[model samples]
Target: MSARSNRQIVLKSRPLGIPRAEHFEIRAAPVPALQPGQFLVQNLFLSVDPAMRGWVNAAANYSEPVGLGEVMRAFAAGRVIASRHPEYPEGALVMGMLGWQEYAVSDGQAIRRRVTETDLPLSLSLGVLGLNGVTAYFALQELGEPRPGETVAVSTAAGAVGSIAGQLARLRGCRTVGIAGGADKCALCLSEFGYDAAIDYRQPDLPDALRQSCPDGIDVYFDNTAGLISDAVLPQINRHARIIVCGTASVASWDPWPQGPRVERHLLNKAARMAGFLIWDYEHRYEEAIAHLAPLVRSGELRFREEILDGLEAAPGSIADLYEGTNLGKRLIRLADR
Candidate 1:
């Protein structure tokens, strides 16, 4: 085997609400010999996204369920160790849905980005420069439509998507407020990401704190948490405000749906518009977004943090950890020996 073989994290069962270790199985597998039109990729980075929780359950929203006994699905970046296809040569790096494994055989159909000029980091393809970044960028431009001098707020403020969203809003000259779970994340939001203000959702009263943070009413609410944390801010929206419904982190447990404040009166009072977005729906403009974001990242205006586990055997539990807010920014697993 070109890379470490005999390793995988398989789905033991579909999760109920918060996932447990019993939902996953780590196993050994022999690396099959490569043949014509086939390519063997040595996994380098595996992503653990919160969306994986919904994917592990019954089909809801937009994404499909993760079939039983399948290698837990994920986006990953890796190097080609053995290739039999004309275009996919050995030693080339590619990014795709490589699943939770140290090694995988592909027909080259899943290959997304063929690592060429970009020498940033292979792990980034699974995190900031990849799906998370695109999702954040799209939700802001399409849903929030932030304007200069406006006040913008984001939930999940220190997370992968939220971090980028705050920076983008700030870049547009918006007064940005971030709502994260803890003081540490709130500090990171304000100090590291330069958000104008940040509120710890763990506080006793979220709405009161949000009121103090945004004294001038929220102009654009980039919501990542859709329960009480979101409801707390709804009553304070500005007239003609835009509410970008990015993700509902509070409902990540996949359990009995959470109960939040009824905000119909607040919407009537503010006349705000709330819109939900799906990342894949913006695929046609993906490159356009990267074109806009890449230079900003290169110019040091944007930063990314990743909490990476060392092997594929940790993929399943790492995914469960994501929903618990254990990951600082982007959660990833490194399959290659670094």
Candidate 2:
């Protein structure tokens, strides 16, 4: 019989700034025959994340950059089609760092967990029930510590993590305000995501908008884009506010760093605390988060949106699109039928 083929996308070079499609090389190679203790996963969905930019950059980050000539790193959900390992049998659905490929060989190290919630779409394993939801769950509950009637302001409020975080804050009795790029996304934040008010950040005067929307000042600022959005929000923080730094999407580059307003005076005046959060730090509590979030998701209390592309080839450009504010929600690439 002819050998089975694998379609893969590997990093051709490290991106100088935001990664572009030219930095990746798509190739088809013979799928390896699994050895003992190994399994083969036919990836069904590949997650494209904003964090991927940092993953490909040479600069120091929480995780090492994807090496040249290696498969582009990604989170994915797939089913085992061939298995020589007992723990992962054929047809078992799993989620892990499956990279940008139609198939992946696993010795089981990168697997985060096997998918157990069967009621929802499998693609959701990469969204609300996955890292995005987990990030929102812990980052807010642990760091934000929102109180009843407190004001929680979230940047990128129409995106995956921000949308979920805003909803979660609402459930906790905080008045939620969302800051998104356009009027449409702002409407979604109010109508769909349950924000008390939504601010369109594309406006010329962001500081004035923030002041009008958050008249009492922000009690918890969930900062996803830490450039100008943060610059405006910082000045409106209430006394003893908690600022959760989740992402830096607004800035084009972070190498030499972009110059902006200094925050020392604002933080000092408000007695506010600003801290960075990474989901991996709470890895041990994955199931704990799932337990709380899965129910909310199932009951329709926690809502999410996804923007899916057609194939593996669409993966590279999707990353660029995400940074460009073109993606509507959690961006993903569908590789096969679930």
Candidate 3:
């Protein structure tokens, strides 16, 4: 109804570095009446991702940037409270690009899937059971192709994608090494994420630490943070290695791309392959990933953590928290309880 207010966080301007709360405006608008083919979702959990930085940037990225004055783009899990559409009936749980709002209206175009598995927590739809997990599933298994007894290294190893990638590599019989930000995260990588070794990138002797942990040279490098971390991994790559370029968390901008040490020589000498992966490309196979991952997650073989903020108001600060390494795992905002 027009009388009902929908709280939203709008992108006021494109951010240069890590986005600040000031770059976004929190406001309330009257919830619009639904038209034919439309359904209204009362978003319960909103995902806060590191990829949001690129989403809000003015420069070219994987997708179009969230335009100024628009609701900041995000993934969310919610229940349909009202619907003019027959397929998406009221009380149906769905996951989609619901944006940073208390509610979202959809025609089912952007809906990723219906949240069918209820045994696990619904928030997992945005984490290990969602995009983050799917990214790890296909990227490591398909792109990385990590062979048994090989060394697999992941950057941002305690973060969502990296953590799962490390665990998946371990399951495949690879020697998994996690490169994270600090001692606490490194400890988590070793204990919780099933990594054989952990390297803290913040340590002054990172190169030495990496060499010690991965003495045989990395067979698969699941690169999430591509700046300094990738710089370190490049020289340690073994022959016929695979590098999965999933994210660039360490460096914010890519338009006037900052120069780094050349990788030509390394690839030539090692006969390694490096490629970028976008999950959207594998949208057709999400069910396969979910089927494979849901069991592992439910079985407790794959460990995950959710750093949930209390309300929709916490949305703006969540991105800053992600970039600053304040969150231990998948960062999400609890808008309402299903």
In TM-score terms, candidate 1 sits at 0.93
Clashes of 2: 0
**Candidate 2 lDDT score at position 64:** 88
The digit string of per-residue lDDT tens for model 1 on 182-282 reads 77888889778889999988889888998899999899998887988887888889998999888877885644666667877777777879888888798
lDDT of 2 by residue, 223-333 (tens): 999988899998899999999999999876776778988888888988889999999999889999989999998899999999989988798788899888887889999
lDDT of 1 at 185: 87
- Cα lDDT computed for each candidate against the true fold: 0.82, 0.92, 0.91
Which residue pairs come into collision in candidate 2? Answer: none
Ranking by TM-score: 3, 2, 1
Residue 17 lDDT (model 1)? 70
Q: lDDT by residue for model 3 over 230-327, one digit each (tens)?
A: 99889999999999999988887776777899999999998999999999999999999999999998789999988889897788878988888878
lDDT of predicted model 1: 0.82
Q: What is the TM-score of each candidate against the true structure?
A: 0.93, 0.97, 0.98
Model 3 stretches astray by more than 4 angstroms: none
1 or 3: which has the higher lDDT?
Answer: 3
Residue ranges of candidate 2 with Cα displaced over 4 Å: none
Cα RMSDs of all predictions? 2.2, 1.3, 1.0
